[model samples]
Target: MAASVQGGRIGNLPAEANAFVGRQLELAEIAGLLGTERLVTLTGPGGVGKSRLALRAAHAAKAGLPGGAWLVELSELRDPDLLTNTVAQATRLTEQTLQPLLQAVCEHLAGAPVLLVLDTCEHVLDECARVVQELLANVPELRVLATSRQPLGVPGEHLLTVAPLPLGERDDAVSLFTARAAAAVPSFALTDANRADVAAVCARLDGIPLALELAAVRLRGFPLHRLLEGLDSRFDLLVSPARPRLARHQTLRTAIGWSHELCTPLERLLWARLSVFAGGWDVEAAEFVCHGGPLDAEEILALLASLTEKSIVTRDGDGAAVRYRMLDTVRSFGAEWLAGLGEVEAVRRRHRDYFRWIARQGEAEWLGPGQRMWAERLTAERANLRLAIEECLAAPEPETALELTGSLWFFWFACGFTEEGRGYLERALRRAPDGSGPEHTLAVWAHRLVTVVPEDLDAAESVSAAYVWLADERQLPVPALPLTGASLAVRGESARSAVLYGRVGQAPAADGGAEFFQLLTLALQAYLLASQAAFERCAAVAERLRTECAKRGELWMRGWGDFFVSLAGIGLGHSDEALLSAREALTAKWRVHDRLGAAAVADLLVAAQAARGEEELAARLLGISRRLWHAAGLPQLGRPDRTVFHREYERRLRASLGDARFAEVVREGWELGPDAAIALALGGVSDVSGP
Candidate 1:
């Protein structure tokens, strides 16, 4: 089937590119589920055609549903928090409103006849289950079809366990083998002489489609008799009488092993090294991480091509930057071989070193216009970064861990990995060598900077004191002085923070007056000025910082600059401009998962709406701010100036809307939940005249 469009809308289902070989019975059965079940999950082993079956079923169900069937591919999604955003993007639900993302999804699907197909839920099964359950509970007319390696375990989920193709003489398995074999060697056919041998191969593989396909590719390399002899020997050593059920699984393992045996030693080594990656990787990454020992950079591509041709490593995308991934089963096998080879530590060290370099590169470039690219690149490499941390901790090299974690300070702050970043820093510090060295001092300072969020005043104060003590004792420059001033600002000491910020801002720049540190120092000053209600000065400083952020391609500080601009606008009585700037600020905060930043923007948005006589919308945003406060993990994380203003606006809203209706609206905002509340805040208009 091709991508269908009944109206002008192109549904999210990928075009069925290849000819689907079989599963006619399974398709019909799953299709029958469309009318009866809200949740139907197809569970099976890897390469048994769960994804294909799901696409076919979704296609068959498409015409009956006016909203159309949508498929959300979960393989590439790394962060569970992004599940709602990713689905929102896939469904093209770009209507900007003051609604939570999940609420927006619900509002879009409410009472609509739609089919949502969630594919590859195994890696994110819990998150998938939660989202699916929420969608089902909210959208009565919506149905879900999911494909996974196992059941989603949600209540009332209808399970259709997909087994291998039948092993009968004229079954789909035999047909699949014959078809793929003919593709490998056009002249090859199932003649009477070779029919028994083909049947034996299919039966031996227990009708698993991937194994049959792999064997078919070997037709050009080996004759039927020789292939059968090799399979027999591998099975004799691999198959166990005690694990008869596991024998079915052994089919794919043996096929992968056979393919491995067919590779050159260097190819096998590359394969083993490639297993270290958590997700798909490009050629540059492969060369950086996998090229060593027998494998060199130039030979890497040729060896990779050989593996791809053998169907061991799947190549995806196009052009010079094609990405590659091993099937989960294949990757697991390669990982096992890598462990046996005892090259795990050496390979992991290289992996950590490469990603460490990447972190440093990101830090250096993150203040420029390429900042977004760096952020996204690092986001994609999040899994690898975690793997590097894991390797460091396992190596018991806390010093390396400390450096790696410190290098990623900007990433953690910009990407909203506050808790996770703190955890790694604490882990490294706990295990770090006890000395008054730079490494230990940097570790302590890095921990303090992350804890400098608005919600944790105690930790912020404690760290700020430490920085002061360290500076006094060392009689030298403290790298954390900038952060110490910022933490003081968070603690409502804006006047005191301003003095310290001025001193630090005038201090000699680090790393040869790098743009990053300049930007950081400037942003801290702007926020401090805004906190002191210096509206004109704050606006000037903020506009300058925003320009620098734009010029450098920086996001985090640019976002904060927008937040302060809105604050300055409010102080200067530019309500309309404040509302607009707050939305922009909220969008920036959303991009980085900066909950505290979002909360600050939400508070400003609430006041802006109230000032513009948007009482109900203002009240609704007050609700959003409440949920945002939940995200910030404190109900009163607003800066001192903003906190008092928020209360004053709350009083105005209550007086305008009346106490009862205001309370009701606030409750409504609370019910919108954090995700939808943030979305609503993001999409809120400058003139909030609506209820």
Candidate 2:
């Protein structure tokens, strides 16, 4: 542990033995995750010493990594766009091009192991997630330990959520305070004399290490109780306490301010512009904010590099595709600076414009092969989109509001963000002008999203009226925006679905292709309804629609169609065929990591098990299904009517002779057409006349 506390040092953790305490469990966890997995995120609230703890862990494990551990701090960088270059600089990489930077990073640490520490990454978490995913994909044998407020939420991310330090009944906050206080003043020991005052200081600061450290520094100037009194206006009062370290470590605010001041003017400007971003931002957003006049994206990469060199802006992880963010405290500092910059309106305008383009791209691609890709992208960009919505609402920008909401519908539905979808609709509908393209477009989107998931119909009705006018007055073609081919299929009334599908199917695609998905959906609905009318060719049409959907890679619907095909198979009296189809549906759901979809498939799986007379197997699968449903916070399907699905189970159960028993089955539904039949059937002979 021998080291000097001078300005420049390798790994930069305090060399003193007494400086590190607790985190044995955390160390073991970091060790385990890094030993096996490439990326591990240590997440907790701000000022919890995630960075210090990560530095210490890296110092401890540095020898294990022959290439030496490097810490990249990201709290100061205002632009998420340059996150990757920041890491490259931290590793002392000399590459200019992104490809070279990545290659240099990989080559430098290749065979020779290194722990890349990505610290204070919550705000730039999306960029961090992308970079981590990329690095882990490309860089072999390298590991990343990231510290953030929440998870990075990337695939295969191991979250080591750091909790506030364990406190004794008397408050570990005071113990920590006293220990750190004793470091500055040797005789400063905790006794009953000043215990109450010191304890008050710790509690007021909420057990955060930075706050505690700042509080401990006040012993040089004020009494413990006076320090407690001064915490009311914490930022102004306690942000500049006396400290042993440089001015940066004196107060929490000053520490952050010091970090920010180290950045260049462009980095500082980008940082301040980013104060408007609530959660996370990307490079594209940084370009939009930092460009236009003199400061164009033409020079953003170099500017991003300079900021990263000073350790103000940090690369999130190891990747060419990077994002950046600022800490809340740092973001606050940027906000303070941004207020006087006089480009608030212009910057916000650019923010709105960039996302409008993004929304347009999303709207165009939703029914294409990149549906899930866009779903994940929208999820990642939600914070930026939210900022756009808030900014547009406060300004003279009704169109932005409409486009923002309309662009996000697919994400809101596919990802099960039902309440979020509704909230966006309410805002868009309120802000929408009497006559505008955005208004008409978003109203339909708002309407369709509401209908898709059996949500409140109030929004749906208003949007439906808007849709009527859009077609009659504007004569806008089908699939204009919100009322796209896929959304129309999902949320539209069957009659409306038919009409819209008919129009979109005939309209030419952008590249002179066909809207085959729309046609396929219409054919399925026609075939399903036509069977009720005893149409002779209904089944044939259904089979053809399935083939066409398969040919077109209707990935989203194929999963659903699996269950529908099972029904078709049952209707055709092929029980084995139905079971196979249902099983495939369950497997697809699992493969795609769709827990909700898996739960939906669970209903089908139960039917498959029951129909085959596997009563025990049915109960077991139902048990698993219930647990999965509960975990997903979803209510169950109401008791299904025992039709071709449950008849075989009932027949076998009822006629079974001696030593056999049947129990009543319970089910859940939000009260649909099938439930009435289920209720009546279950009412007879206690749900079964079984043995």
RMSD of each: 20.3, 14.1
**Each model's number of backbone clashes?**
10, 8
Q: How would you encode candidate 1's per-residue C-alpha lDDT over 166-251 as one tens digit per residue?
A: 77668788899899789778999988899889998877665767667667767777798777776654333333222422222345
Model 2 poorest 10 in a row by lDDT? 682-691
TM-scores, each model vs. reference: 0.58, 0.57
Q: Give lDDT for model 1.
A: 0.74
Q: Write the per-residue lDDT of candidate 2 for residues 1-691, one digit (tens) a residue.
A: 1111224444433454456766678888787777898788886545667777888788878767655677888877668888878877777665355455555556655565667889877667678888877777766767888886557778887877665565442655676788888986777888888877876676566566777776776676776677788876566655534444444455667655654654557767777777777655667677776685667787776776655443344446345336665545556666777788887777777787787788778767655566555655666677787777777667675666666676666555545455566677667767754646645565554546445344334343344355545444434444332333233333333455445435322322222122432443444453333323323344444455555557655544555556566656655556577777766665544433345555666666656656666665554445455555655454432223224344554455445421233332323221222223222222221231110
Evaluated at residue 508, the lDDT of candidate 1 is: 36
Q: How many angstroms is residue 70 displaced in model 2 relative to the true structure, after the best TM-score fit? A: 20
**Candidate 2 deviant stretches above 4 angstroms:** 1-22, 25-246, 302-322, 432-438, 455-545, 570-598, 609-691
